[model samples]
Target: MIRRLFSHIDLMVRLLVLAIVLASVLPATGRGYVIAQGVSNAAIFLLFLLNGLRLPRTEVLRGISHWQFLLPLTLWCFGAMAVAGKGFASLADSTLPSTVALGLLYLGALPSTVQSATAYSSLAGGNVANSVIAAALLNILGVFVTVPIISLLGGGEGISLGADGLLKVMLILVLPFIIGQLFQARAKGWIVEHREIVTWMDRLSIAVAVYVAFSGAVSQGLWGKVSVGDWAVLLALVTGFLLFGFGGSWLCGRMLGLSRPDRIAFLFAGAHKSVAMGAPLAAVLFPPAIAGMVLLPLLAYHLLQLVVSAPLANLLSHDPNVG
Candidate 1:
């Protein structure tokens, strides 16, 4: 059944339509809003756990040693975006607020994605295990690193991570994967076999989140504060960043003279970032109003990447040059 489903592109099309509809109503309905937030957190946890399960023991450990390109690139790309995005505020006419700083810091702070990056890597004919290791490692490191950097960049309005909060992040984000890893052989196979279920749940979760987040913005009068022009500017920035990360990683991997599989792995795995990962973490780290703003550019980035990256993935997949 799952194999038949995978053969049909229409399933994705249909699910996407459903996601669009659900995203429309998530904000106004209070129950749905809370459920969306819960699902967002739960889905991220599931994604991390599934990622850990796929990672071979060796690659998981080697993620530390294999800091070759990914580590520097992650920092560099994030730094570049922060510097570039913050300055973007001056070009716009919106009332200057802490969001300018927060947006820039968020550029530097959010983790690389786990499931989507790995899936993109796999779809692009990359080494799935290596991608999993890289993605998962990025996620773990994010808890320790994001807050301090945000604090530095944010100044008076910055964020911080207490020891207890860090512990809780580890518990919520790390411990689930640790447990999943113990039973991975059983779970991963089932998930892979039921790819439709996994895809549906993942997309449903994200759609609900976008709905709630965007809805919350409406309720908070973001439209009055953030104009159509601001949205356009934000959209442009996100598109550019996604292009840079994906293309830059590919070029970097090629320059490293990696094998085809490894280069492909690095390209896709190193490129993608997560907006979903930021929502809960932002709630934990920042004031509520500010947290929502922090989420905005990320949401833009996430959606832009999906639309832009799909064709890029297909192009890479069939590229005679890659092999």
Candidate 2:
């Protein structure tokens, strides 16, 4: 029983949860906040560097060739999810807070997560290569697509499309990836040999990001701003959003005549949102006052997805029929 329980929970989840607890307790104002922010930024940059180095070029090429599979996945990530976000907000009427609702809509518009999606897809016997390429493209396009969608939804109030933000995305996320890909041939053997090191780095970076983001929120009296009832409603909406993504992706992939591996890729790539990018993007997009509120839903959704997906990935790994 102990082994079974331990097997189900991922270390990354545990670290992130711990980080949140610590963030809540720790002092985030004055010099501490500045220090936390700097650490978070550095960790994030390194995380992307490892991500670029680890991507398998062969799978990326294969994934790109299947444009038929890619098209719907893209549409679902950007279009269907965005529509569902607004629809859920409307359904909430006056129950949901405006800031949280706007956050959900923005979350929907954000891109798929590269690291977790690729990792989960690989664990589930999915097409890792295709996932890698698809996830990368989504983030790249996300820099452009997310801002526009947020603007359309009135979530872009006080947000400016700064060249610095776009450049930051490229510098932190894309540039490292390109460099890694460039030297991939030379590093492939070493990277594969030390894959576990890369995984830990990814987890640590995310944990730091969570800590910094929540530290700011905690400092701002996040719990005071949001009532228990509001929290419940937001949780419910986030749960519904995830369920829709998971179920719809599986159903739609089948309907589109995808192979089992392709379906698995679709399932993960369409369902997972980029926690790696969410906080930084929010910082760039929203005002400091509302940014914490806007960030809460994204953080909640990020943690929840990892919890839900871990077991699903385990099941898929064991199921002989899935691969």
| Per-prediction TM-score | 0.71, 0.83
For 144-242, candidate 2 gives per-residue lDDT tens digits of 688888788665554665687667766766677788888888988988898888778888887787777677767877778789999898899899988
lDDT of 1 by residue, 24-82 (tens): 44344467656665665676567556655656566667877777756664664456444
Query: Considering every candidate listed, which one attains the maximal lDDT?
Result: 2
Give stretches of model 2 more than 4 Å off: 1-8, 90-93, 114-129, 158-160, 283-289, 310-323
- Structure candidate 1, residue pairs in collision: none
Write down the RMSD of all candidates, one decimal each: 5.2, 3.4
Native-to-model Cα distance after best TM-score fit, residue 35 in candidate 2, in Å: 2.3
Report lDDT (Cα) of residue 216, candidate 1: 54
Give the candidate number with the greatest TM-score. 2
| Reference-based lDDT, each prediction | 0.62, 0.78
Summed over model 2, clashes come to: 0
Candidate 1 lowest-lDDT run of ten: 89-98
Q: Could you tell me the lDDT of residue 81 within candidate 2?
A: 85
